[model samples]
Target: MSERRVLGGNQHALPASIFADDMSYVALGHLHLAQKVAKKEHVRYSGSPIPLSMSERNYPHQILAVEFDGSNIKAIEEIIIPRCVDMLKVPTKPASLDEVLATLKALPDDELPREQQPFLEVHVLLDKPQALLREKVLQALEGKSVRLAKITPHYSQREQQDSLQHRRLSEVSPQQVFALSWNKKFDGEPTEAIAEAFETLLTQVEEQE
Candidate 1:
């Protein structure tokens, strides 16, 4: 039982008493992190045995072994599962593309089996788009003991706003597109009357289609 959200909806925890007092054990699922319900020793979640996503790389995976003595639990043991492959996030903190490339180049050069290679995630801080970014990153990662996972690029708030200004025509709403044209031609926002007329015409056009 968990007092956690489900599918974005709030959910109240099930009463631990829902399990009969004499029941020796209760196993549950649907949660990614292993936990004991209401701190009850007999209730448990085993969680996932392997990393389901890079975000879950740090979750402790385990299998619970239970011993029963005439229908009552005599012992419960947690057996930790060993990690099969490593997950590496380069430049753990977001950094410029150059710094990310440098870190990738410095990764270990061991010639391990393909299945043994660690999974690599590149974290980049972007101020502006750079040409040949994928190619440059790939070249830097050559011979590294890792399998390239994906590149994650993020921008500062100011830069993100500036980038949004150049979004494609289809990505902008009709009103926003009209506002852009109006400003370019008149260097000011459209007057209320003009904006109302435009919206009326836009509605009529939409109805026709």
Candidate 2:
């Protein structure tokens, strides 16, 4: 027997009864990461031909070949697919726009065809929107051989801290609120400098009011 959507956010479980000791092999799909299932060597996910997301850029995609001899598994070998295009996340985390541009400018010159050029995703950490965000990125890519797929901006400081004033009043420190709010929005924690800067901003705002 076989299954699909075992990965890609699908939570359905693969039944063990299909992988009885008598079974020789099972081919699976819907998971971008190739992996074995049910601790059975014969049951496996073929994964996608290419990485579907930036998170999977590190590993090479693969195809599995299973040889069978008289309904018994003979061999399982992996064939690595050549990357025709690349998916890269610059800095791997939130960083200054200049730092991100610097990284982009430092990339090895891409002389390949447009389709072969790497797909770059830039991460920019800012306090507010930059009106010329796309223009700035394009300027940085001048004379470069790459496709700028996206510029994901993360706000380091909360744009509306006052909204949390009444909700989390019990929180003792503004830094604590900043950390919590960041986690709530991005599902991740802020760095020490980011938290401290937010605390300083909160203090300044209080003084003004």
Candidate 3:
């Protein structure tokens, strides 16, 4: 029988042998956190040169500079790149989209990453985003190295509503109601066989107790 394994890190996963090679250099993608994967000296991931999400706000974005000699690793260097995306989560009030665009446009050309330089991704978080503001942001970043990955609005409000609803439902103490709500709100109903299997497993656990 063949066995399967799962690898987890930085949102992108691949087979164990993906990097097992004699190549002069291995450049990995899908990870915002850039680092060398093996002690082989040439295998490295050039993390996103710019901040793509709020989780990476503190991480210093950089690129990898490597020298290869025909299937052999020579030297590896990391070049610090400029910030192209401004991932800010602020209230949508008062801060119009034009204001945000102006702020970005006003940034010195040196501050903005060049289009031919490298790949860049940016995410802007807002409490409540306006349609006009979003349009402006898109227009400003068009053709630039910067691209908006997400624009979340009213995040706190949605979380609060869900929390309140869950708490209220839990207080009723109705098993059937809870089951229905859980299936409806979170996970949908399982197939008849799957549900029966789970119930049997639960009964066995209770009997053991």
Candidate 4:
């Protein structure tokens, strides 16, 4: 099998058909969801023990318990893992500064053990930079039983197009150049995390000079 269409999606790797004749059970990894491949109970992916990224927040993380009798899989059971800490995106979806602030402030304030603290990602729908917006969110999260992860600022398409203006190439910094190029190619500003990652890499390169 060339392009193996598994339970998740089509994988370009080894086709499940190649192991069809093999009597041994195949346990695979890499895919994030625990599932069987090619409708075969023997071929499975246990998936990650926890959510690897924000996109996988809703994924049910579990361990697959396979009972083997001789060379065949007798039974396959999914063992659900208890979530020690929750991952929360304030207001669920991107919201205005006021709405995000109110939701952040209204979060569970009870002081729990550090290990039990939920991971929080603050999502703010911004058309333009709000003065001290991140600072205000941090202030609101103060004394709360949550670990602040990152502040995600989603810019509107109108705001992105508004930034398209001619500027002297030499007058702009590397970050500005990157932003301009990104906006021109993709028509949107890079996320805060992406910008920070580029900055970090830039700093490292400069240090190596």
Q: Choose the strongest candidate by lDDT.
A: 1
Between prediction 3 and prediction 4, the one with superior TM-score is 4
Which ranges of candidate 3 are over 4 A from the true structure?
A: 1-13, 38-40, 84-209
Stretches of candidate 1 off by over 4 Å are 1-17, 129-132, 160-209
1 against 4, candidate with superior lDDT: 1
lDDT for 73 in candidate 4 is 74
User: What digit string (tens of lDDT, one per residue) describes model 2 on residues 1-209?
Assistant: 32322333324444766677777888977666677876778888877888765545666689998888889888999999998887877767778888988987888875888888888878788777788998988988888888887777766445535444467567535555666677788977776456435644553343223
**Model 3: pairs clashing at backbone N, Cα or C within 3 Å:** 127-154
Q: What is the overall TM-score of model 3 with all chains considered together? A: 0.37
- Candidate 4's TM-score reads 0.66
Backbone clash tally for model 2?
Answer: 0
* lDDT of candidate 1 over 1-209, digit per residue (tens): 53332223323446678998788899987555567877999998766677665655555678889899998999999998999899877776778988898888888789999999988878788887777888999999888778888787766545654656879867856866676677678976676457656755654343223
What candidate 4 gets wrong by more than 4 Å, as runs, is: 1-12, 161-209
Question: CA lDDT of each candidate?
Answer: 0.74, 0.71, 0.51, 0.72
Two-way lDDT contest, 1 vs 2, winner: 1
Candidate 3's residue-wise lDDT over 124-173, tens digit each? 33454355656766677555544455543322334434544657664633
Residue 99 of candidate 3: its Cα lDDT?
Answer: 60
